[model samples]
Target: MPQESSHADPAPRLHRVVVIVDANSNPFELSCAIEIFGLSRPELGRELYDFALCAAEPHTVMRDGFFTLTGVAGIDAADTADTLIVPNRPDTHVPRRPDLLDAVRRAHARGARLVGFCSGAYTLAEAGVLEGRRATTHWQWADGFRARFPGVRLEPDVLFVDDGDILTAAGSAAALDLGLYIVRRDHGAEVANSVSRRLVFAAHRDGGQRQFVERPVPEVPDESLAPLLAWAQERLGEPLTVADLAARAAVSPATLHRRFRAELGTTPLAWLTGERVTLARRLIERGEERLEVVARSSGLGTTANLRARLRRDTGLSPSAYRRRFGTAVG
Candidate 1:
């Protein structure tokens, strides 16, 4: 539970975080915590986070249909934690134990950072930590969350909502995004990128949980576009035309366009634009170069074009994006 640093020193301090898991905890959310903070981060030139897995009671059954675990480090663990993470609890089945609620409330009362992933927000709400915080949970549970905690501000569309000391993320996948954000906030963008690389997950997604959930699963039958997509990504700096794409994919321009829309949910040009913008954002986040330099390197060609596209997509212009995420400048 180390505090998020405004300016992380070259060698940042180590932190202690505890994952409060219950029988109904989602394995994916737990795994997200293990990936980000539970495991050793020596590769990121950091010391290990004092991470522990604590269950509500002595022996708790997991959601995986198995009666396992007692690694429960009493509720006292929360008292000394630098940060506390609550992964999805055992669905909304069993009511939370009073001991569990008291422990969470005690930790948050003393200014410890409290985080909830997915249905984990329920526990925070139950503990009264989210009384005035803007929080979110799995979209499917929005109604239930509102019904239970009318005092808490709920924003259902965001992947994750950060209200100062209290943070809540939506769904299992958004857990990964929130975890990375925690790393970013603590150690800066570089450490977050390193963790993302180690985990083999994208550092960020364009939209919220809606984008991820409603994303169309493409038909990967005889019309697989993996090869063409790979080719286009490598040649992003080039001015790619419909004919150029069709020639590379060994299909007619019309056929290529159709496949692009079907597989990626966007036309060839649009997808290319997205790719360029994504690349530019990453470069900017990395604190590598100036706006014009990043624009050219990421294939956006010019700063003005990068600014227009970035603002439209993220509601933040290149300069703002740079200042917010650019480590060197910041």
Candidate 2:
């Protein structure tokens, strides 16, 4: 008998991500999932996820029968998924298949993170997992969603909602935003940025709405807020105020405020605070040990402030977060 070679060390388990493909599902959102989680990335020097698509039926016709999706695993794949992407059905009036809903409920019950893209919120709600959970769906269907599922707290204005185990993204491009966010959450800022660069997408998008656009009409645009944003990012260590930001932009504070709301859908002070908090998170993930130093470097100013902000944004204290995501312990 031939000698048997010793087995190599067991490979590490990659996170399993399964997307549910159902009838009338939009191909755009499905493509978003494939781009984000399914595609192999040799450029990243590692595989990010074990991705699969599953449906109640083997051959399902897609949105308006644009195409038929086949060669996918059966819906039972949801049982083994670490994260489940719910179906993104466009027809809100049509009910989801019972088996698909049951799979979603089982995934939720097993504590697998569940995601809904666009009208996929309808599927999650239909599964009864989104009752009282914070979520966002297509803005156009907000009224109908509210009327149907009064228990689910719908946030229509935002790009996405991250409620721990359950997440939802508004229609279309918001799917990319939420997907990038999940990448950031699971991997880290650097990894997420790399993936975004590959996709030609913004890694940490600041806002969702073009609620308003402030610029010169019938003429060239007055100015883009990009320059101001770049300047602020460079000076995050300093104690910068909204007024200082306005002055740097060479505009009155009031005009700056309007522009902030119009372009970013957030107030100036809120944006500044958010930026600082983001910097603080990056610092923590980089294994910065001193809480006060992380706070001051990020312009959050105090250890207490850093702790509060970290808790609010990450649901973890600074130390806890470092332990979870840090490359090396300080």
Candidate 3:
């Protein structure tokens, strides 16, 4: 695999970064920051950032509906941060708390870069920080957002949007892409990619939202299909039919279909197709290979079928997928 650039000189002072958590903050978004800035990266020979979790009150709490969070630091912890991150909000309909809004405004006024993830855009929007700015959020909330904040231009599809001082990212795990992007913007691609490698994730997804809006969600179960899936996984080079899978599972075709749906939340055919695509992705990520060979080994049968499946699942062709993932794996 390609390695990130190493800095031989003494590391510089780590920046002060704060992630503001709220009653509804997504743990995953907070994890993105912890991965990018909180973790020590001595192996990369790069100066790391001092990251803290901040909240509006002294003892913070999170809403898991009936469940509440305790032991979180108060919003005062964010007072001196060089960068302030407001993760996704629980609801877009409600306005931001006045104190929280003011805090965000003060942070930006003091030269801190502001970041919002998913519905967290609503906080920035309420703070007036996103006024006349190009931002984004979860696609499902786009219409409600536009209606609520007419001044902010909302781009519903991209993974994230960066306007130098302010950054906004779309739904859920897209926060990872935004965090990596911030690392790349402040440091370099090598540093960001290194962080990605440590997380065992892709180097970078295309920043555009188009990739997320149309991608098929794989709904495979790790348990129910264990044996048959294991069998299928080991024999990707051979053609396997529904009948073959049914026999292996000791079930009728109808039973197999029901089991796939009940266990995987998808049809048996779709599950098999996803398995094939997964195999192709692994091969493509491993290194350069002939398209026909990859297709054959992954049971995609032909380049045309591979192309169709790849495009359908990822909105990218096989060559494009290879170019993106293969280079990183190299």
Q: What is the lDDT of every predicted structure here?
A: 0.76, 0.86, 0.76
TM-score for model 2? 0.89
Candidate 3: give the clashing pairs. 1-330, 2-330, 55-75, 157-209, 158-209
What is the lDDT for 195 in model 2? 84
* Model 3 regions lying over 4 Å from their true place: 1-11, 65-68, 211-330
Q: After superposition, how far is residue 111 of candidate 1 from its true place, in Å?
A: 2.5
RMSD of 1: 6.8
TM-scores for every candidate against the unseen true structure: 0.69, 0.89, 0.61
Please give, for residues 136-185, the per-residue lDDT of candidate 1 as tens digits.
88878898889989999999877888787888888888889888878766
**Ten residues in sequence with the least summed lDDT for candidate 3:** 208-217
Distance from true location, Cα of 273 in model 2, Å = 1.9
lDDT of 3 by residue, 1-330 (tens): 999779688665677898887766677777787887899887766455888887776544554654455666787777888989975666667666777888899998898999998898998988888999999999889889999999998988777888778999988788888888777555544466678889887555545534243224458644466688778879877888888899988889999987765554456676677678767766776673889988999899999999998886566787776665564421
lDDT of 3 at 183: 73
lDDT, candidate 3, at 61: 50
